[model samples]
Target: MSAKKEEQTAAPAFNLEKAMMDYSGDKYELIVMASILAAQKGKNEEFRFQPRDKVIKASLAEYLAGKITREQLVETYMSERKLMEEKQAQEEKRLEQKAAAPRLELKLSGESL
Candidate 1:
């Protein structure tokens, strides 16, 4: 039982120095992305699953390491944004349709529908 608790409480290992070494040039871009994403996560509950800073750092490191191309990042973000927007639009349309549907309220005082 004690061993299970210890394993569950273990902290994840992080190597910041290695990550920095992996990413080169235009650190400002990474900073901006991280800040923007962090703010978005704070306001949007759906985005809180992954920490913004970690996402930004890992993305930059992967880019520098050539694990993923910059174009891939751009494409991924654009596609995700597009999908989210589309979903929102569909939801709005559904709500509008529901609202526009006629609702019948029968009065109790011998009123006709």
Candidate 2:
């Protein structure tokens, strides 16, 4: 086995590019806890699991409702982002279909058909 092949087959590094982990002493060390969990769970080669600001806000709703724990924030963000991406894909496909379809002209009541 070549070292280069082994290196290529190795697992991708976890990337969490955010300052959320910097703050402490508030909310029971939840930020650090969530950061750790996100790093552990969000392992992918294509992209890092970066929750958008909106995703963070949306997850806060779930947190407030007691539906999700603080540590689940990143996980919740992933779920919401995936669902949003799916909806966006569907909408884009629909628009393409609409654009491809032929349009019909409708005559006004007072105009000739």
Candidate 3:
């Protein structure tokens, strides 16, 4: 086989520019979404199978495959961040209330003596 053909075969079919154009949203948004996806996927055990591929490429592939969208990714990330913030605030409030709660102390009673 020719070296040129071998090189073509070795290269992935994915075209980054073409994939970005295929995305319905703006290219910039697609890039942002890929970044967010990579971060999210990095933390996920299910996505750990593709350790050889860069997270960003895997993320972009996911977008190209139509498995997810920029809006969905952004919304989900924002909602999760908000929920985490709320949970942290609640924990802080709980700790504050516990600290503020009056502690009862036992006093010696003359009657008992």
Candidate 4:
């Protein structure tokens, strides 16, 4: 077998441009890619799961390459961001309510409001 044929039989090299082109027509997949990009940017160096970002990026590329649809990628990342935002908002509201609550203190026997 020729060296070129052997190389071809080897795993294909990763191609980001092709992946992006593939998913360019998909709005949801684009959104998912954006979110994954965001998450990767926000990841801390101390964390062990940072490698997942690469996986997500690869998946995005694969999806863009027509190996997967926008819906599939969207279902995971889009919903996760939505749910996280909602939970964050709820927590913020709860904290605000707690902060806004009136404080009461016990007075001495002779004290009165």
Candidate 5:
């Protein structure tokens, strides 16, 4: 008798709602879960999933699970970190310019004048 072997398939994309339904305890549960998963997946050794990444992953999972659409998830990951960094850099430049500015003082006719 001949036996047939099944083809292996990649794991289904993560499902946020299903995960939430499965874990259903707190709001941050999804973030924590994704972080743990990401850590295990070795996405980053620092294992520090930025807030933006956390939101993105959660929303993406939800969309993949048919709970939300890709468009909805698009804005969820938009982070202002880059803008903030640029603003900080500009502020530092301004400060450095100010510090580098020259100061002038004039002393006229001490009391003898």
Candidate 6:
């Protein structure tokens, strides 16, 4: 019973420093990507998170686990940005068309005198 309790109490250890050191890519880029991912995770509930999970740590863990890559992140960001810019352009075009459109004013017969 004591052995089972002890085993259950032991949590898997995660060494961020070691993981960072072992990563084959640029360390600075990794940190930047992780920071961005952490910010996104913190602001959104797209992923189910445990109450004890910290966004920064979770993001790092995902990277370490090979679930996400820096290239994938960059590509996703670029695509989303492109979509936003396209939407803005379309909105601007629509607004210009609306502004250029002609408007008609109906005059009251009683005021014509």
User: What lDDT would candidate 2 get against the real structure?
Assistant: 0.56
Task: Score candidate 4 by TM-score against the native.
Answer: 0.45
lDDT of 4 by residue, 1-113 (tens): 99999998999987877656654366774756655644544455643355666655655565556665546555766787899999999999999999999989778897976
- Residue-level lDDT for 3 in candidate 6: 95
Evaluate model 6: give its TM-score: 0.65
Question: Which residue pairs clash in candidate 5?
Answer: none
RMSD (Cα, Å) of model 1: 9.1
Q: For residue 58, what is the lDDT in candidate 6? A: 80
lDDT of 3 by residue, 1-113 (tens): 99999988895776766777666767787777888888889888877666735878889888887889767898989998999999999999999999999987666874432
lDDT-best of 3 and 5: 3
- What C-alpha root-mean-square deviation, in Å, does candidate 2 show against the real structure? 15.0
Which residues of candidate 6, in runs, are more than 4 Å off?
Answer: 1-11, 21-24, 39-53, 106-113
TM-score per candidate, chains pooled: 0.55, 0.35, 0.60, 0.45, 0.35, 0.65
Clashing pairs in 4: none
The digit string of per-residue lDDT tens for model 5 on 1-113 reads 22332223545656566665775346574554444444333444443455656655654464345564334333333343466688999999999999999976666877432
C-alpha lDDT values of all predictions: 0.64, 0.56, 0.82, 0.66, 0.54, 0.78
Candidates 1 and 5 compared by TM-score, better number: 1
User: Which candidate wins on TM-score?
Assistant: 6
Worst 10 residues of 1 by lDDT: 33-42
Cα lDDT of model 6 by residue, 1-113, tens digit: 69989888999677777887788888788878887677567657765463334677789878887888778888877887899899999999999999999977677985642
Model 2, C-alpha of 55: deviation from truth (Å): 16
Query: If ranked by TM-score, best first, what sequence of candidates would result?
Result: 6, 3, 1, 4, 5, 2
Across residues 52-85, which tens digit of lDDT does each residue of candidate 1 receive? 6665565444454566555655665678789999
